[model samples]
Target: MTTSPLSWLPLPSSTDRAEDEPASESDDQALDPVQLAALHRGRDAGEAAAAWVRSLSGRQENEDHALALEHAAAGIERASHQEVIPGGEGQLAEELRYALGADVLLGATHTGTVPDLAAGERMPLVAVCALAAAMPSCVLGDLPRELTLLAAELDAATAAGRAATTATGLAG
Candidate 1:
């Protein structure tokens, strides 16, 4: 008796959604060249960081983890502020920027409704580095190599970002 407009429509099947919808919501947006390049950089940075972490020899000593994190934050901040790009910052960039500034890895804990392969391996590690590089109280209990891996990952990500910006003609 309470049937409104919702009652008449049939539920969509998986196949219907698979054929009509994009794999992720970000795919629906019309990204310009700059945004596209920046996204590419973000993806690659994640991959590169993951690779670096996977290849690390062992835990880092009590060297200057704070300095490493500070450098990474500075690099990410600079990229976020790049004015040459016109379309504005994309989701990935903003997330990375915030995580870097906060010295935390929000992506590691984020559970999104949509699955994104572009962020499959790299993003998690990228966030890990954001937290690890700082050697905060929570992270102090982690392994030394884990901290090392985080630093290496951040370094790789920053380098990847630089390469991407240069390729996109957005480097200054």
Candidate 2:
């Protein structure tokens, strides 16, 4: 019999544990402040975007596009639940950053400036763009079609934002 290299690793038991069994205390102790904050922000952003997408899906001019958006929203919601696993917080943060950027662009395009967004509410959107700018160049071809479209949309928004700031003499 051949043994796989991963066979030595501990596997989770399929048997159910008693309800009285104590949970591991290490779970809460594992995360640092930054990671915890990222997880929270990612969860909140995912929930808000999912709700927004659900509402937007109802008003779509194209049924196919609406369906795609609904699926995307569900995927985002599922990713949000990954916070309990190791390294899942970072994954959620990255996914929400791209998703939120696309959401911001869509909302801004459909409706003019959202004057109602509080600073806290607006922070994730701003952070998405800022992080994108700081990161290495993206190869859109490597991403899935949906994400490619979202990235393109965000790129256009970045250009528009720059132009608006320049026109307002806010660019230094």
Candidate 3:
């Protein structure tokens, strides 16, 4: 079996994973690992965003994706680079945000099969912030302090994931 070197990142707690949710190969088709990490990292962002939205009178309980979520994420990120991400997030947009973010969280939370960078590797904070800036929301996005907090949380989550995997010696 070709193990990804990313195994060091902690697998999400059972509480974090949606059990009773059927497996949908969905975005598994187009994913190449990096995007997945981004989605995994982004999941926390989504949760945070959802809380923010709820405070603003929005309520949404997320659904497990039934199809192509990661490919959609990469496509959307690509689109953002190609053109200016538009302003305003409607309900559809929030859902899309959740999907992409969840995948990023999945991606960011693990990285084991590689024989390349060892277990403790992390995507730099600057890169994380850059990615966040590219999100469709910056125009109406929270202030700098809030953005910084998000980046810090991502760093912490990634570190926690890595620590979990390393502690088990199954990371690499």
lDDT of 2 by residue, 77-131 (tens): 5444232233222233455455435554244344433322223323433533433
The lDDT of model 1 is: 0.35
> lDDT of each prediction vs. the true structure?
0.35, 0.39, 0.34
* TM-score of candidate 2 on Cα atoms, chains taken together: 0.35
lDDT of 1 by residue, 130-165 (tens): 533232221233323433443455555546534544
- TM-score list, all predictions: 0.27, 0.35, 0.30
In order, what is each prediction's RMSD in angstroms?
Answer: 18.3, 14.0, 18.0
Best by lDDT: 2
lDDT tens per residue, model 3, 62-164: 2222122333334333223211222333112444444345343233223322112224332321233234435433324442333345445644544553454
| lDDT of candidate model 2 versus the reference | 0.39
**Best-fitting candidate, scored by TM-score:** 2
Task: Give the distance in Å from residue 65's predicted Cα in candidate 3 to where it truly belongs.
Answer: 12
Off by over 4 Å in 3: 1-138
